[model samples]
Target: MSASPWLVGPFVDMLVGSGLAYLMTLPLLLIISVRTGFVGWPVLLVTLISILVSVPHYGATLLRVYEERSQRQRYALFAYYLTGILALVFLAGIYSIPIGSALLTLYVSWSPWHIGGQNYGVALTILRRRGVEVTPLVKRLLYVSFVLSFLLALLSIHVENSNHVPASGLQAARIYRVIPVGIPSALVSVVFPVVLMIYVGSVVGAFVGLVRRGVRGWPLVSVVSLVAAQALWFVVPALLFFWSGTDAEGLLPFAAIWISAAHSAQYLWITTHYARRIDPGIRTGTYLGKALLAGAFVTIFPGLLFLPDWLGAPSWAAGLGTLLFAVVNIHHFALDGAIWKLRDGHVARALLRDDPGLAAGKAEASVGLGRWGWRVVWIGGSIALAVTVHEQFERTVTLSGITLRSLDRARDAIARLEWTGRDSDSDHLVLANSYLQAGNPDAAEKEYRESLARRPSAEAVSGLAAVRIQRRDWSGALENYDRAQRLDPDNVDLMIRRSDLLNQLESETPPVDRAAIRDLQRRSIRLLERALDLDRRRVPTIVRLARVYTRSGRRRDAAALIQAALEGLEGLASTERAMLEREKRALSDPRSGSAAGTRAGPVRPGASGARP
Candidate 1:
């Protein structure tokens, strides 16, 4: 009951966070006709994969229906879940992946809230299994978590709304990915084992009914152990030194390798144990174990790629973990659970024995080299994971330009903070600034897509329109600009950019409608006029109108506008003034021509015959 508050709080918060992410795509939702359409593909894929891999447990048992030759029927969800997870695992194993991995990673590695959500689901399942009613505390905490997640989502949305983002540099996203890799190799190896113990301990506690037994007794003792162990991973492990000890920073790789191997062995061992006596009678136990193991390797690993490095994490440890799980599942849990049903409780009796109850009969077990073989497999898997990591970061694309680094830095920063207490709008604003600075149109565009996914904000639409402008995607720019204008009609920059795009498009249309051309010209003038109205000292507004006049065929008006803008540049340096003078001359000269030799064209129908 005491732990209930912590569990429910994060769980509810995660669900609420997910819901906010879901709702934030409201614009995209409107377009797609599904409220959660934007995030659905990845989430559904992960769920499907998780569910699929879980079935082999069932298959293993069903095989014993005693007829290896008989046709077999398997549920579809099992396959789907397995597929999703395996897909992710394959992604982690490679140096690079196909486009699908990129999209899938976003859903799988979205935030800690997602991981917390999964944990909550597991916790709730536990509550149901024991037929325990959630006390008022659990309910209250759940509501709190919901509020927290909602608030975070709101914060994320707010961050995404800002425009002062970096347009080029180390995208913050990529930076997040790199940090964990460098997590002082000394501590790397100890993390998984420590974490694993806690997870397993929690599972055991559940079985022992410590959770049901309330706080302060034998259960509390176990809970205390679990909490202390878990804290060491996140906090500086001052006490674990007695056991895990210290290592030189350079020795981290070997440690990581060892750690990975240990987990792999553990998971596999547990899985096999679970499968062995997992009677053909029931459907869940063994299959669920296998499915979850596969999910660990596939979905979890692959999903990390989408995570910014900070939260991204390495998978060799998880891979090692999967193996470790197999051992515990089969030998420790499954075999034990099955033994529970025996009339005399044979399985429990065997587990209690140090001599290996129901030991593999001497000849059948062939003890020769068996233990060593497992040791080898465990070590090998860890080595493989390390190798995979070595390959993933073999090259760096930054250090070449400030723009790239700035963008990368910002992306990592935003991704790291996305789940804490922010909404999509705020997250997008942060992501947008990074993307904009990075000169990465795709990243910027993604923020826009994210914006459209949730609630449509004037800022988000405008940011998207600006991204469109950078990409030279005039049509999209125009569309987003229009939406932004409707949301914030009096915004000066939006009007100017929108008018500029329209004018540019009008020029490109061959045999364009004279009425439309005239309308655009008038619109351009009005927008410039509006900008000046918003801020009378705006020189850029003056220059922009001059360009409009030139485009519209009024050379005299264009010249006068240029002179006006120049008058405000008295404080500019000599070189700057000279630059401005040359620009003014170029605009005023009829033959000052654009594109090397071509003369400026007439702006509209029936104007001075300079359409050439």
Candidate 2:
């Protein structure tokens, strides 16, 4: 290969297989932001760019499917649209928030598999293009790399979320409900390393086959590039986010942006190639043609499909915005799967260019399970794996109530496994809360302290403060809250909690010096005022803050706060409105003002006061 091709080949492959367009755009955008000293606009810019690149691909595919009736049957195309409409209707009319949440969960869970499938397909395509003969064992190794990596990544996330993993002996026994077989949660925690090993093993295995059989040059490079790209795209991103110790939930949007960009680019590359092959005169490869087509499809089509989201009405309005968006995605997945059949003659002609070596490789891959014994074993193993996963999930759901006999076994196994680093701050916060719920204040306090030592996280500080409050360490609680407020001063909940904590301290303390007590009460009023400034329409905050104001001889401010809350209470539930009304009544009534001040208690941050 020429030096230019050697240098540029990997990048060219990326453009066709998984566009690094967003990757390129993002870094450049960040550089500009650094220079200009404005970060928010870049975020919006990147979002718009992602939508422009991704939405068009979906639109273009649907438009092609609709316009090119010769490539696809009429009924099939009609049914595709019908399915989307039905999905939207179901999502819009019958879908509760819980149902929508469930669907979103399912979508997120399935996404890794879908993305992995694409990566595997691209790898296979590269292997074929480079004239590498893919054997049955080679195919299995490749598939295992993708499957194991995806599963390990998924399981790592699960373990992080639940923090309870069984090791090899008893814990594994309890977890799997099996003897002599076990996979430890600690092993799951090392999923990143395991995934790397699998990918490396597959690459080594492929290279060894090539060396023994005397295939070198571009073929070896092709295999390596495929493996490297998969690692860069999937493995590295997951591990980077995982090891960062921040909430992995936040990484979803980042993953979606780059993954969608890759998927769109790959789909467009192949589809445009097919289009060019079918009709040379149509010229989808040209800049203007692509722009006009992609632009038109984006403008005219998806808007009509996703009009509900665009309406921007209230939550109670006749809108299925989320449903429509999700329906389009699911429908797109199904439609793309059905349409892009490489086995078809036209597709094979376009993709394979009638290469006999590639064709033979494809045949060998399909014939892997021709033997009945092998098929039986494969089927049995798959069914067993599925059952094990299902049972584990069921156990997790009922873990709080049910005590499985084997759980002790699993716990013992988990306890024996050696951990490497300290738990993430988020994990510590979660464990602290869980310990608190289980009536273990000591453990909860320790976890909170450990979390704070690692990072001055607002959540951890707030949790630590709450623990101090439970232990009646009033000064300690106030100090923690002050530390937390410095970290996240705008967090209304933290402010309200601190304000309430001050009130509780005041109520519990006997008045040694009335002036000192009044100073403390004034501090509470200021904290609540800051919270109100941050979130003007929070009725509960208004109520609690108003109560504080009334106690500290600011009844006029309390009355004004109640009036402002009432003005913004249109969409609140009846109970919520009623709660606010009670606050309104207390503040308005001259007789109850003194009573409201003396009857102070801790406000539960996110919840309303109980008839006080």
What are the clash counts of all predictions, listed in order? 115, 4
Query: What tens-digit string does per-residue lDDT give for candidate 2 at 1-612?
Result: 111222124665655564445455555655655576543333333434434555556655654454444433533654456665655654443335445534433444455566677666666665665555678787777777777656654554354343211110111111011121234657655765767677678767866766676766655555555555555455655565456654322332333444556666666665665555455455554522343344333322332333222343112112232333444555556666666655565555655563334322222211322456334433443443333234334334423232334333333322221021112344455556766655567877787776665445778877877777666676787798888889987888777777777787677767676786687788888887888788776777777878878877788888887777778656877876887788887777788763355546653421111122
Best by lDDT: 2
Model 2 misses residue 563 by how many Å? Answer: 41
What is the lDDT for 452 in model 1?
54
Model 1 clashing-pair count? 115
- What are the clashing pairs of model 2? 170-409, 170-410, 171-409, 171-410
lDDT of 2: 0.54
lDDT of 1: 0.40
Task: Report the poorest 10 consecutive residues by lDDT, candidate 2.
Answer: 167-176
Q: What is the C-alpha lDDT of each candidate?
A: 0.40, 0.54
